[model samples]
Target: MKTFTKKLTFYMGKGHIVRDITADIQAVVNESKIKEGQVTVQAGRSVCIISTIEYEPGCLSDLEKALEKIAPRNDYYEHSKRWNDENGHAHIRSTIVGPSQTFVIMNGKLCLEPWQQIIFGDYCPNEHPEWEVFVCVIGE
Candidate 1:
């Protein structure tokens, strides 16, 4: 078995930003040179998340709206009450959705659905200077 890993960082300006990282993940798969395996994408912070979603205008808008109702950024979270951090909502949002995702690598390509795209979503809009994502690829 062979294993490969890589790390990436991004500085999100905040306010519900969704970025497609499919290419980046694919790049890692290529770099790993793994013919068949699995890759895991994870965020470094608890306030952010990694997941698959349709990278379309309408679906993207709906996704944001769903997050708003699920874990409204403006709502008061006990985490914020303790830390006095407005990003408490970010914690809740990430917990509800999760912060990491796994994808299969086939023939050195990501086996993703047509509409599915990997992305890092920021539910909390803070002046966070940077966000990091870690990739782990392992298999034959």
Candidate 2:
């Protein structure tokens, strides 16, 4: 078995930013020549999440709304008091969503539904000068 890794960096603005990264990941799998195995994509920060979803504006907006309700930004968080950071909700949101996602690679391609796509979400309340994403592909 062999493992291949790639990193992507993005500068994110304040608020939520969801970007579809399916094609990028597929390129990594292709570069690895991993005909069959798995690809794990991970976020490099506590305030970010990696997941798969229907990459549509409506769905993305709904997700952001749901997250806002689940972890309201205005709510008081003990973590905020400790760290004196305003992004306590960002941490909670990331925890609920997760920091990584794995997809099966078949026939040297990502096996995903027609509408399903991998997404990298930056949930930080403030702008992130640099957001790093890691993609790891393992197979033969």
Alpha-carbon deviation at 124 in model 1, angstroms: 2.4
> Which runs of model 2 end up more than 4 angstroms from their true locations?
none
Model 1, 67-128: lDDT tens digits are 88888878878888888878887888888889999999989999999999999987666677
Model 1 C-alpha lDDT versus the unseen true structure: 0.88
Q: For model 1, which pairs clash?
A: none
RMSD of 2: 1.0
Task: Identify the candidate with maximal lDDT.
Answer: 2
**Angstrom error at residue 88, model 1:** 1.6
Model 1 scores a TM of: 0.96
Question: What TM-score number comes out for model 2?
Answer: 0.95
Clashing pairs in 2: none
Which runs in model 1 stand beyond 4 Å of their true positions?
Answer: none
